[model samples]
Target: MADSTPLLSDSESDKPPEPKRPPRSLDETIERCIGGFGWLQIFQAILVSLAWVFDAQQTFISVFTDAEPSWHCADESVCSSFSNICQLPKGSWSWDWPAHTSIISEWGHQCSTSFITGLPASSFFMGCLVGGLVLATLADSTLGRKNMLLFSCLTMSLSSIFTVFSPNIWIYSALRFMNGFGRATVGTCALVLSTELVGKRWRGQVGVIGFFCFTLGFLSLPVMAYVNRSSSWRTLYLWISVPTILYCILVHFLIPESPRWLFVKGRKEEAVTTLKGLAQTASALTMSFSNVLIEQESLDDNVDIYSSIRILLNKRWAAHRLTAVMVTGFGIGMVYYGMPLGLGNLSVNLYLGVTLNALSELPASLITFFLIGKINRKDSILGFTILSGVCSVLCVVMGRVWPSLQIAMELISFFSACTAFNMTLIYTLELFPTCVRNSALSMVRQALVFGGVFSPLLVAAGRKNNLISFGVFGMAIGICGLPLIGLPETKGGVICDTMDEEEHRQTEKGSAAIPTLA
Candidate 1:
């Protein structure tokens, strides 16, 4: 306490205060550099989105290419697809379509082996589950967004092309697994990269593009399948494979590395170059800073990079968010992937049924975009999931009475599930820190695949009892959404760039009281 106010000399007192590290925010710098969303940025985003297109394509292609075609029995004694051959004349019991065109007819899996027919579809999801878990950290660590995308795209393309050479169902299923494994990182990396390429103002818009692309890819399946209806199922695989390979090559040549990633990696010069290229492409003003930077590097550059899962788990609040999000995603995944596959059991028009289901995506996307802006994500997801569950029960109730009405109910169910799925995509991006965003999303995707893993089996049993099939789907979606109600409204929260920032922001958010109008 001695001479508390008399310590500073004249020279020391005159020294200018050391500038408070310029509010050093890396996320702010990235948004500033990206500026307003431009046409050039849109082009890049579109090109990168090819990954999303093929991801959707490969996922649902089995609905047509692997379907069990309609068949009549040779005789009451001889069985076929849902028909007793013994009840019909010998020559009248032939397949309605050529055997070579479908996996079911071609392999004689129609009657006796029908129960296990779901193995291949289940196998694909299993592969996705394994691959997503194994490769979840790759994008966040070494491959970065562009390279991870290129790798996933190439792997999926090559695997699909090789599927054309499968000798039997065993070989075909193996190839499908490989294909699923290869494509595992595509959507996660593509989504993360696309959002990262833009500023906050355009993030929601950029996010919307992914849903549209996925819907387009889903829609393309029916068209491609319709065109190849007379052709062998192998043609469908080859159809998607060849074009996919060419597109991947184009993607390799076009898309740029995410500059934010470069900056975080201490590659500031490269980051500057990427920013410059973006500016030049858009014909916009270049950044004019000779001294301080936007604080791109992390505060602890000396610390070794940790896996996203580890980082997420280390923080209590982050761990809580991760658990809730992944669980909800799992439930949504079951309905989203399982409903369409289960629709094969519908007695209505198969082609028309799929077409209607694909069309449901458009409304889902539009609705999700509109609702996400108005209310919070938590409510939207919760509402849509419960609706999907209700519709699932409705599908069973109407299934036996009116097949058309049943199919109509099923369509609504798919539509609701699809909306919930879309919400999960954007909602996930908002939950985690940017440093490990890709990995976190990938982990959640694996959780989704885990749920998808069991759906094929459910669909297989669906024909026997609609209750068991749709009931599980209903319960899964409805129950999982309960935990999400506790999460705060993240409608206007900024995407946190680092663990420290996310923790601090969440702390502030927890302590702050909601304002009430008098």
Candidate 2:
């Protein structure tokens, strides 16, 4: 035994010295540096969240621009105002509004097929889908969140400028596609960057800031469109696009890169500098970043832009979590995006109905903002989705008898959806670690947008039958939440910074037989 002791000691010494574990983890260190959600952090988070305002503007702008205008009988003897515009002779009816007020009136597509009318909206969504697939990993790999966000807003605004000059519907549709492509990364980047800039304690609330800004944007459109009711759709585009260009410039100069992202990318010096700039006190800035080493696996700056996505797919647990969240997001998105667009089906005035729905988002965002720390992500998603679906279905059932009740039900449905949408995004952020958080969130957003791709068609079809759009929205959100049962609850769990760290946590939890909260 005495002779063998030397060999054991030698073997122990031969093993590489375990990297000195920091007294505090990177998350804890970051939390310490940010000084418990300082005002500076709040200001930055709100600044980034403002991007959602423009995003929401671009998103729902078509609701007004492509609207089917109110038509009047040019010759009342031949046709009434209620006459089917498609069946009437060209000179028999004319638009009540100016020809340039809406694309439908401007381009003489008032009587065009639904396919033609919905084409631009659908093309826009397709651009979002393709753009998400292509740009999802760029934020995680090369550009970082701020740069990617800046690029997206720049592209979106520039394309909108070009859209002002579109001579035909085809050109307008193509430009709308470019706008969607550029806008695809805006919400995701903003959400991730805003949340990442703050401590975990404030992440949920910070994330909801974007939702509030989005509601503001949604509300702004009705006002903008109404004020410009007699003006050309091109003017509305200019109003939205020009300010967005100025916003991109502000973002470029004002926003800093996410420190967490920098740390993951092996840029410690920059990460430290960012944290220092964000720190409210000189003492907090004094904490040494030297010991805040990332896991060896995460330090590989040579990782390809697509590596984060591949990692998500290759890992069975991540794949399952991703699949479940994405499936659930698809349902929430269908109602969230579809409801407002389908509001034209309600008996309320289009602008009033849209304004009411947009207003509903305010309460939804507020609820999430206040209860974020206490809300259970899975339960909230499930409950709100179920409620949204029931109300949507009830809208179809009760709409014919009481239009007021139908709009109320629609508002309730949208409110629930907005809350669920907020939670879904926050939930997605919690499920993944820093290394792949952007990619995972991007994929989930793609799922959301993918659902929206079908919304215009459903809204168009619902023009004739209420059951198609509202009913489908009800069924999809209600049923899609079941897969969440298989995913682990992320509430109160510290977010990890690397894939290996996350996997280790899962393994330890599994070994300890920890039960997940519903």
Best by lDDT: 2
- Per-residue lDDT of candidate 1, residues 46-126 (tens digit): 888767889999999999878867666655454544345434554757877788788877877665465467667877887
lDDT of 2 at 14: 92
Residue pairs in steric clash, candidate 2? none
TM-score of each: 0.90, 0.93
lDDT of each: 0.78, 0.87
Model 1 segments beyond 4 Å from truth?
1-22, 73-82, 85-92, 112-115, 280-284, 289-294, 299-306, 400-403, 511-518
Per-residue alpha-carbon lDDT of candidate 2 for residues 357-467, written as tens digits (9 for 90 to 100): 889999999999899899799888899999999999999988887766888888899999999999999999999989899999999999999999888888888888999
Residue 60 Cα positional deviation in candidate 1, in Å, after optimal superposition: 0.8
Model 1 — which ten-residue stretch has the worst lDDT?
A: 509-518
